[model samples]
Target: MTTATGPDLRERAETVLATLAGPGARLREDQWVAVQALVEGRRRALVVQRTGWGKSAVYFVATALLREAGAGPTVIVSPLLALMRNQIDAAERAGIRAATVNSANTGDWERTYTAVDAGEVDVLLVSPERLNNPDFRDRVLPRLTASAGMLVVDEAHCVSDWGHDFRPDYRRLRQLIAELPAGIPVLATTATANDRVVVDVTEQLGLGRHDSGDTLVLRGSLDRESLRLSAVRLATPAQRLGWLAEHLDALPGAGIVYTLTIAAAEEVAEFLRERGHPVASYTGKTDPAERLAAEGDLLANRVKALVATSALGMGFDKPDLGFVVHLGAPASPVAYYQQIGRAGRAVERAEVVLLPGREDRDIWAYFASLAFPPEPLVRQTLAVLGDEPLSTAAIETRVDLSRTRLEMLLKVLDSDGAARRVKGGWVTTGQEWVYDRERHQRIAEAREVEQQAMLDYIGTTECRMQFLRRQLDDPAPERCGRCDTCTTPAWSTDVDAGTAAAAQERITRPGIEVAPRKQWPSGMAELGVPVSGRIPAAELAAPGRVIGRLSDIGWGTRLRELVDGTDPDDAPVPKDVLDACVRVLAGWGWEERPVGVVGVGSRTRPHQLDHLARRIADIGRLPLLGTLAPTGPRPEEHANSAQRLAAVWSAFEPPAFGMPAGPVLLVDDVVDTGWTATVAARLLRHAGATAVLPFALAQKG
Candidate 1:
């Protein structure tokens, strides 16, 4: 066992890098500096370099050196399972044994834990969320902190709210670092952090102080020499798809096709498959096993591409990935840079193209709506919470927030020490929590700036690479002669008519399953609703169909226009949309056809809802059973399931007479939470209707 120091340190690092990469591999100058700072100086460092600049090498090499000196295992706080798997494989290549404990591999945890405790593991990678898990935080982390030789924070930008991708879970690392023994070497690495994120992450790494001088920040040029950047503006999404259908195979090599939403990812993958391209859809909703399999297929080049959403934005490692084609631009230039950074890592030249859509800003706005809630909402949440533990669903019943927003708020509150998440649920900590209105406002404004920058990046006639690099505040931004603006587009932007037709046909093809709400939202009884659990079979609405989801690439755009762009005045449904709705009904393989139509009264689109229901009944030659009368104004918009259910529980009154004896089609302009339809169907069931089949123009994604 020997210590790694001075000249010996570089030699050890080279040996480890050669083993990790290949025989000819040697440490880059900055890579050595990072390793030396960690191994010899035992200092904290933030290494912000390009995607393929070997940041992982620094940590792995330092781990090898530190372990050789009989130090404890290096514990890496990684963000994703894919990244952990990649890191473990990379460590094994250098003869440094590594293991991980994440949600995906719970079965291996005890074994991994035993190995780590026995000093048989050289590196241990844990997800950021694990840092807050009670078992890990109370038992495992303290031990790891006491004996860990080096700490690494991968994708450290997530630690800052200012980052494009922030996770409250990453904030727990600040507490972990504060508890670490003094002088422990720490490394935070990210490829996408701008100066703001850099400052925020540096402060977190500096023992939780903004002015701590013990941290080293190594930022390099963001230029990717092997990436040929370009943007292709098409008249429509169909044209973009047509371009992909015609040219995906002609790109440099196998790569990724990015979409903004899950429906788009699945839709794009399916269309590509129809066009005889080997592709798979990957999204946050994809099964863990399927995601792993898709990742493997992409790695082996078994598929031409994996059409994916932002879920694939981080931690996927494929050095020779050939290209990245975005169907729609990401909201932020910084985020765009991070996504495209996945490509051209080891390839001589990988194609990076953006197909900016007219709908990109709409998608951006959808995400922006999920930002921090207003101060009043936060105060309301605090008022409802007490010292007693309550599940998130229980809180949702008391608050007016949707489940996602509630969870986000809770995480923020937990990070701020205003609340604590326990075994069963969350408990208020009685700590003073100030809503940082200014900070949140600044972040929101920053997001807007980033979005504008992305749009500008698409329309800019200047060097594309320079624009992106400058957005990341890269110190040495320069014109990349390879980009489309600097030179001619390396690939053709033409979309064949036949290809465009096929794409348009595929996208316009509509119908999405609107799954029934089997179980009533929990705590509904607390809200004065009679239901508390699963709806009785006799009262449950049959699973039905919508023309399409609001997130659909083709029908979605039109539906959004109809629903969001239209004035409040009542109007008949467009002929094409009505035709599409009819087609959906024709294709629905129901056990029994609806005998009548029953409309759910709508406050926002009364004329449209009534017109749609009347037309649906007339088209199907079913009787008009009459619309359900609203007992009150539309329930509070954007409320959670429990709150929504409670609000609509008795809000609709069924017709007193002329009850349908058979199945009835329940119609609405849109189904957001599905609670409105649920309550209406339940009312119809109780009103002597045999069955209720929900039909809607569109379902919100």
Candidate 2:
């Protein structure tokens, strides 16, 4: 490694080291190398280090080197508040002056602009959201032109859609980098990235013709020696719950139970609590106080386990977690890795269990369907609003949708820039806003068709490590001795026979074929159930009431509408009534039919009403009863897997020194869950990971 022993670089590194080490200080070999590279004015460098690998030490040293070279100021664009706070705290502890500007702290545009323009701060840490603020662009960024020394894009993987965290705003960072003066070095740091992401980062940041070898790509093994990877097949919901309950006693230190939805999260939390397990729940819906308290309890070891919806692991620094359980399949491998990564941070042996079932896959499919809007819809939406801002109401009128649905579609389009919102409402900027619509749509469709592909790989009767190696395109050893898939005998017979049998039985059952149902209203009887009334009719119709009612009764339903035999203009049933019926039917054990159904009572089972009432009573006792509905999946649950993966790609929370390394486990509901996880995991592992293990609750037989 090139070492910077020059007086100038040495003095700078020493100054920074003195502050970092308190009294007497000495530079570590890696820190010294980083400082030397910075002093050499290398325009681009890739620090590929493992968890607890002192990546930040290198950055801190580089910061000091810039300061010593009389470079005006450095800007650090970080993804998360916790990470920014962590950096700021470190600087303060070292007696080095630093400040962070984020949504939480930017009191006013004027003050923020003044601070940046006046050069009141030395090192500035900011979130991407703050970068788009008009004040920041017009005032703050302009001042940086004269004094901008180095720009660091932290968690750089977020810039790529292929990454776990695909933030639209992050894509605009290229413009920011372009605004900086020529010859100003750019440093991009991330814990994970694949070849694609690295190439994309280099091109996006305008770092042309840089030697890829000199990028300092640090390749780390994906083996987690301290983590035991295991999985269990959950033939039924009761079995899954029982397995969780049984394992609760064996877990030591902090633990996390990842579920597919908020409802599942709450259910698992309550079930554990009822079984005398000290547990808490965390989801996007969790209030700030609840979230903080739950996080604090987990960190302080006051709570043994936290049942969460992929929201508990980001920016969390707990290193001694004993176990992380997937109550259902995580949406993707990326999600699985991030959740599992939360455990064994303190170096002790930790365990991860993936409870697989068909229900998990169904949940994943449902969410994946929403991730990318249909191509026709995107095309039509753009066509209708050619560069004119219209009120949300007007857009709804044009699209023939409820305000809620219109808003969601608009938001998705806005993110892609196929549409933008002005004061009045939303408008399509142009066709350029539609980003690879065909590719995006294909990815979405692949999620449906290839649901079994990942599950087959995960549950393969072949070498598990080999399977992972193939999936990740890893060029190292052909076999990884670890992994349940590697050790478990590959079963020639259908791996998910039970789930397949159940779905097949439902599909082949003799039943009356009804026309496809449009949106509808809830009936009084169906609405009588407390948790059943909260869901809208649209959800009930798409999945159908039979599946919804079955879900209410605790039976898993994986229903998808077969697009045929339906009048597009048919008057939809009342939303409330439809939701209630779905809830009621789900409780009755009505097998979800393959084709869509308009009327109720297509295939009713016995005692469904009783089960629905009991489920409502069961849900009523839970703390999240009012906060999250019992009948349908929470909105947050739909995005749980994606969010977790995004957190890994976007949120960079450095491990504390002396902490043990842990393997990242991506949990999802089903391997067929979505491409989100596959894409996410590929990116994370490519970004210099030690290992990425994926766990699913269930797979399609």
Candidate 3:
């Protein structure tokens, strides 16, 4: 009930709001409250509102008012590159100078820092990842923190470990907030936080203060009248794709088509394009320029949809996005809500649908394995990371971690004070690091609960929008009357027989090439393995074949079932799979057909490999050079390249033919890291085969 107290404050804020939002636009009641809290009271505030509810307007107006009072720049700790781009543009519209310092614009950092020092930048947007940059942390951040007038955490839900989109980089915000000057206004905003996430983030924001009672929290009901939510439980992946191809254009306006995996996104986009839909694929692996173009196409309404993964979520502002369709349900209702928030922002109605698939949980389990590495792995990483800094490439040789997993682990450790990234690369801090198993276990449990809730959402006949609102700890007194459950169903239940058959054929006709390892893994010297440098061309295996990616929907599903079996009865390859291998060979068109077949004897799937090799040799009339016997049990399937290489090196002994050298076909159950194939191929070549062509039933992409 305290008065805002300054007549000029309200007048200037009105004018700034007019410029930021359109000329006739005015702040909502909660928006004005947030601006007043930051500018006049200099109080900490958290705003949890639905998307397009003017959260950005609150900060832009605060920045304008604060700058008018001669304050330093408002530092916004944003999450994604797309979020940063939207923020920079919003800042400009409010007549505030904004500059971003992120990984994308490295060359502009000097100029950006100079502008900040000179007090020419009014609002500075920075990615959370930048907070971990050694140069930014040691040099630039101190000055920015000491002089910053306000700190705005956009997408603040990510600050909480309990959030659906938890990021280690966002955790560094706790230390940053503690370092800020007392009474400097701080604001946190997110559209997709439940009660738990909100509490965690509020506590994080109040770390420096003894009491959080004064921290203003404005929690609004999560109800979007503009969205007409619905779900269609498709039995097969092909049926879902076929439904999308036939019905995508019928959805109101240009929006997004979300898929669970990058492979799915690419496949969906390709199928849509072949069916004559103008769609582009967007994923984390997309090139930077291509991402911009894809975003622009969707924004311009030039394409029907951007087939994308979670990369397209968070702070992508398009006022009139018309629809959102999911090929597969996201792992959590919170995340699904955030993605569907992209639609119907400015329109009276936007269509939203989910086509849940059976294979989604398998994908989720694969992702779950990437959680914070085990304690042993972490300790091993620290032991190799000495006082002297070692580049990631150098560390990769000594560590058995892949590039992505290693970098993610390094960031978490860096934020936790157990590791530091200096000028050269990464170094251990010699600090004690606890595993905190109970906490991660709780998180895992919560994830499982969310996933079950998602399944319930697909099965529930109750109000779809209301169920989502309840998942976010918001109540809806009555059902949303627009969803499929609330109203009569509007779409057809089945895809045409022809279309479904063609879609299934397209997905089932699989022959994915497994590229051979050309260069040896780095840092092998550190692991007591002397081998390094490029793999010799003669010794390396030729590009081989797999029926499909284990992440793919068609043959991949069967492959996963085959490899993940608990019983010994499933060892031998099935006839359909064997016939599929023949189809692969018939279509592969190698420079020369294999003169002989050699099975990489498996300790696990021995019958499958032997049967596949024997059948291929029998059909091709090629010599059966017999098996590559193992000295011991094969390496752990989940082990990284270097570890697998160490286990498989000198482990395989191919039978000597004592005949003229010729190309040999090496068969295995799966191709994951390719190190096993590399080692086995080397042995086969040394045993007198001119070349080795590796083949597997599946590729774990």
Candidate 4:
């Protein structure tokens, strides 16, 4: 092995880069500075560069050089599985061996561990969540920390709450770094960190106050030469969709279509395919297999576009991805920059556009609600675990958090040492946990500020690239002459009348199936509800329909306004909504038309439910069977399925007019959770109805 120095390492880095990026490739000045800091100086470094600036090359080259000097394999903590896979492939091209351990490939963990322990791997990539897992944290991490040659934090912005995409799991990396031996030479890299996020990441990388001075911070101008940024403010979502349907294929090359919600992604993908464009929908809800397949299709240019959520946000590596168009604006400029970073990395030019929507804020608020749980709920969760451990399902019966929310809370708790997740379930550690109200409030306020910044970005007449760079506190930000403001707005600003009309018709058409629950939530017995396992088929409510989901783009807009109104003077039911409901019934194709109509009495919007049922029964000429009465005070909205089910079990009384001889239709304002429908149907069946069907103005999908 040769002595490591800046001059020596730069030559070696050139050889590696030549192999990775053709024989003529040479290291950029900043890329060499990052490599030198990690290898020769043996100091922690934070490299904040725009996407496709060869940040990964710095780490891969450093790891190869350090390993040649007999150092242990580099351990990379990546944020997404896509990143890890991409890194592994990139590593192989440079003649360096790499392996990844993520949730998607647990079966390969043991084999990978064997190889890492035996020195067959040059780089090991693992997710942030893997750090808090007891098996890995207690077993593998300790060994890796002791012998690791270099540590890399990919998408390091996630370690900071100020980042647009913060994950609680990423915070545990502080502990991982704390446990590592001093001067192990760590590298943290991200393309989207603003000033606050950069400060947070630097502090984490410093490890301790004494080492803070030694940490190297390299922040490059965020302007991407290949990107031509533009924003189009459309009046309606349909026109936006129309524009995409008309011009998506005309974009430079294969690229990504980003949506704020999964439903929108699917809807846009379907519309594009209908327009004869090759596209696929990829969201967090997509199966891991399908996501991987979609990724492959995009990488190979087999599909012209992938309609995706932030699930495809960071760490995806496609050298020449030509465009990124947002169906709806992301809540923050930081987030928008990160998503759009997926495009134009290696290409000479890639088009970037934002179609700001009216519904973006609602989506923002829905996610904002998922922050750290309140102190009382956290305490109640702690109290639920006694000497015996309980699975998440058992805890859900006692607590009122959604599975996703609860799991996130549990991870926070685990990080705080208040809980320990074992093989069977979780057990309380009896640790004291402080509820950081001030911190949470600050985070929320920061989100608002960022959201406002995003709005500013969309409406700004100044240079788009310079605006983004200024947000990140770039040292010398300036206008790039390629954006719409700097250059002419070359894109079309109109949706043809015929196309807009067709889109309006398609969007206005509504009917979403409100599928009834087939099985009872687990641990119902503990909640004093005797039911468990699958609901008997005879008692199960038949599949039902709703006018639309409140989260959708079309009727969702109208439904949100109507349902959000709490005024007693609000109209009973708007004529347009009534017509839509009638259309639903007209096209229902029900196995049996409802024999009678029954309203599910509501504490709020009673008039909405009653009027809808009465109008439906009158139109169909069926008898009104009266409303189901509340047995007692309705419990405040339950948080999770189990809690909601337990509350609704005894909340409804059978209809006073008794069940009709045939199936009865149950009407409510909204069918969120569907537990209300399930319990009400069982009540109607017990009251001697042959069958029950549920109808709602909107669903909370």
Candidate 5:
């Protein structure tokens, strides 16, 4: 193998680019600069260029040159499986052997490691989470880090907590970079980071804070000439769906329709399918196999669009994707730019639209609530920590945090050196950890500022592309004489009344199954709940129904209003909500009909529950069984499953009438954790009820 000198580096790079992209493909000036910096200068560089700028070309060309020069394999810390797969294909096209070690390919790790050990592999792709993996970090990483030719951090914006899509796992890369030998070229690339995020990521990519001055920062104009940006304000979800039904096919080729929540993704996908559009739902909850199949379908143009959430947001590259539509605006323009970047990469033109919704803020609030908890909660978590390792579930029992929040906190603590994750679980290091209240507050405030900026973008009469670029602090901002405001509207805002009516009917038709909990949450005994394993069949509530999830686009809108605490606590159920409840009961395909109705006693919203139960009893011509009385005040909000069950275990007393003769309907206004219903149903069974059929107006998914 002949290593090209600095004089011929550009010539060699263009040759590799031609093979990787196409016969006539050539390197852009900035691309050549990045490649030279890595291959010749062996310097750290941060590239903040828009999509389709051929950032991969720079890295792959550098890898090719470095390998011929007898350097070790390039290690790329990519964020997603989709991105890794794409990079591998690109590497193979350039005749560079690339292998990935991610959760999806555990079975192939041994083979991959062996190939890396040999000189057979030129590049190794790894997910950021791999850096924190116990076995991989301890055994495989040291060898790779010590001998790595170049290090690449793709989607590098994730390293900054101030960034829109920050992940704690990505922060582990700082240590990895710190340990890398000097003169090992490092490249961090992202398309969506702002000025603040760029500085943060550059500092981390450098060897140390003072040495960050040496890192080359190349930022290009954040402009997509192929995208026609537009925002349509729809008064209702029905109108939005109606617009999609009418206009989805008129857009260029196939593309993605992004939603804010998993439920919304499923809901929109189902609606679009019913409207005769071939679409599939892709979300975090989607099975891994199904996700792969869906991705394949989109790539092959088998589906018109994929209704997805942020799970499909980053690193999904579909060149020539015709359009990118958002059912609800992302809270940050930076995040929105990253998602829509998937489109217009290889096409002459593509459509980018945002159908801003009133519920977007509420959805944003829900996600923000899961951010780092209050200081007292953190202290409570630390107080329970000992030298002995405690699993997340066990820690959850001691703290009043949800599983997601608890796991995130533990990861943060581990990164801060206050906690260590070993084979068993997490153990405290007894290192004094101060809560960075100012930093957290700044992050929270920045979120609010970004959210307001997004709203402003939707309502702005200025050029949409210009507004987005300015939000990202693009050095050069220019009005693209495209977009709805910059020029005449390319898309009609009119929603066909009949189509909207049909959409309303589809969305309004609601009944979501509430699967009963079978197994008791682990470590329940630690919370003073003796039960463990599966709950006995005698005490288990039958699979029930909720009118809708709080995150739903249709019935969820009304349900959210009913239980969002804005309404009077003593208010009765609305007439329309009652009608929806009746509709749900009419369609329930239960083998055994309920002979009576019993309401779960509520200190808050008692009138609502009582009125709903009595009305259902009257309509069904069944006896209204007595309501269970609350034995305590409402349990603390956001309690994990075990703590929630413990608090609600003795919180409800059996009805004064003792028990109903047959299967009884257990009613509540809303079910958050489902523990209240679980405990109440068990109490009714203990009181000699034949069965308990639980139901709720809305469920918080």
Candidate 6:
């Protein structure tokens, strides 16, 4: 194991801090220790500081130390554009040379390539998605790989699936780190993680010989002395609006009211505006220009209240905020904590109120259901896409469903890895699509097990926070002391029992009722040939064709002109035609399989059948399918860690004891379960390393 003499490292750290810290600046005790450890060149370190604890200062001190010691560049990998902007702004303000690369600024391929190759840039702040780009791997990472410096990952919790904000791209970071040069140190920092998340981060990062002792899990009292928390239960929307209006006048600073949906946000904002409150609304659907204007209004105190979706708070450091009101229940306690944490950032007293109603639970369940799709339908969709790109129109025709129904199925397929879209067409992306029959069956079975687990979580009778914490292997607190359950023990118990019993009844009840399918308009029958089990060609043709075809069948001249020389193939089908098809086919039970299609009436897994039925039902409800569009904003590109590592660490001090003689791995944190720690260790072993040790700023009991 590598070791550094304490006195020697402390001296170097002091020197570095003196150069970096401005006049009259002093390092906090924790920051001093963190800097000293980095000066020792431990190679793997985790820094678990509380929110607003100046965790970034540790890296700033380390960077100055490394640069003064004549080390190469260092890299910092951050997850959000807002975070990147914040760090870049701070670094520049301190007179440090720093650059930020994200989708917003680097709008095209050429700009991305140019920024990375520009050798003069010292520090780079980036998102995780950019690492997937081949250009970064080839043009930028090489310099960092060759440098002797440090690599820092901010918000390191994202690497674990158990994190509140999980992203798929984080899973690929281990492979990206493997390509870096030997003896490079890695530093990870996060404000949250309960034991398991810490271990997951270390294991996933592959830090060697770094023990849990190296981890520093800081403990802070949950009781925000400055924040006043309360919950107001309401029976109707009008009552809630009245409460909001009365409370708005009581709060003096900027306030944010979070709602369940974009529509609700607009309505609430409009209602407040009519009452003479300077209000603005922000949601995912708000146009960019309007969003910027709203943000400016809030920052300048021009707007007294801002009604928004949950997207407004991350990296927004507004200290003067007076209140944060949740118009609806947040999906999870973790989300609630993060959202409320936004207030009182300036150490000032703040108010947070949660307004809970029955509808909130349903909304949460609906979103949770979307996260896990039915495996059987997933498998079927994979088979259909089969590495081929097909438009929604073509997919609808092939699936023998209306455009609306097809679109819904496609959404489920995309989420479950059964399909992916490229250039507005779908393509298969799952292993089942390429596997042999037996293996494919095995994959389907495994998925069934996972699906059942997800359903169990959704239908649980226990405290929701407790259930989630257990899933992540973090020990549940005796009581959260803040969630709805803890706030009103009896009500929580009764609600849990009622919801559980209701879920059981819903599961055991008979299938949902379906309305009768509508008949095709007149003259549709003559448009095309009849295919067994398929909707007639007449049903697929436009109303005009149906009329003309009926006239051709001797209905009369009025119907003849309706069809008017149009080819049956070219006729437009009425929107309702597809809607009806979805309802009837989905309700009747339809399945897509490799051997042949099976109906819901066949003996398939119950959950699979339910999902298929739901997909069809959703499709039928859709107004139009052929012209569906991607809904969210374009995804942002990630950053290159190796390059950033080299730039930042080039100046870091070597370990006071010197680098280890053999191959060494490095990591940032560790927790009790060791899920992340084990994963990182295994990856290092696979990469031909001699030893893989885990390190962190703190360890949970």
The candidate, 4 or 6, that scores higher on lDDT is 4
* lDDT score, candidate 2, position 87: 80
What TM-score would each prediction reach against the true structure? 0.97, 0.64, 0.95, 0.95, 0.97, 0.56
Model 1 misplacement above 4 A: 207-212, 475-477
lDDT of 4 at 638: 83
What tens-digit string does per-residue lDDT give for candidate 1 at 475-580? 4446789999999777677789999999999999978888899998888778888777778998899887898888888888899878873666667899999999
In model 1, what is the error at residue 501, expressed in angstroms?
Answer: 1.9
Model 4: lDDT equals: 0.85
Candidate 4 lDDT by residue in tens digits, 1-701: 35467677688888888877778999889989888888877888888888888899899888888998888999999988888888988899999999999998899999999999899999999998898787998889999999899899988888777788777787677777777786688889998787778777777554434236667778877777899999888899889888888788779999999998887787778777877899999999999999999999999999999999899978888889999999888988888888888788788999998888989889889988887788899889988876577899999999999998898888778777788877678898888878889988898899998889988998899998888877777744467999999988968879888777777777778787877899999999988899999998768898889888887877778988888755667568989999999998889898887889888987777777778889999998988889988777767788899999988888987667867578988888788899999999998887877888898888875
Query: For all candidates, what are the clash counts?
Result: 0, 53, 2, 0, 0, 54
lDDT of 5 by residue, 1-701 (tens): 34566658788888888889999988889999899888888888889998878889989999998998899999999999888888999999999999999998899999999999997899999998887787898899999999899999998988888898777888778778888987799999988888888878876554444235678888998898899999999899999989998899998999999999998899889988988999999999999899989999999999999999989966677888999999999999999999998899889899999999998998999888888889999999989989898888889888989887888788788777788778778888999999999989999999999999999999999988888888899844467898899899888889999999989998898788898888899998877888998999999988889999999988877888888777765788888988999999989988889988898888878887899999999988989978898987786665688888888887876668856567999988888888888888888888887888898999997
Candidate 5 achieves a global lDDT of: 0.88
lDDT of 3 by residue, 305-356 (tens): 9999999988688989999999888989999999999899899999999998
Clashing pairs in 3: 397-522, 397-523
Give the poorly placed runs of model 4, Cα more than 4 Å off. Answer: 1-3, 204-206, 209-211, 385-387, 475-477, 660-662
Error of 2 at 212 (Å): 5.3
RMSD of 5: 1.7
- Please identify model 6 stretches exceeding 4 Å from their true place: 1-23, 107-118, 134-148, 204-223, 377-701
Error of 4 at 637 (Å): 1.2
Candidate 5 wrongly placed segments (more than 4 Å): 1-3, 205-212, 475-477
48-80 per-residue lDDT for model 2 (tens digits): 333444556666667666665666567888887
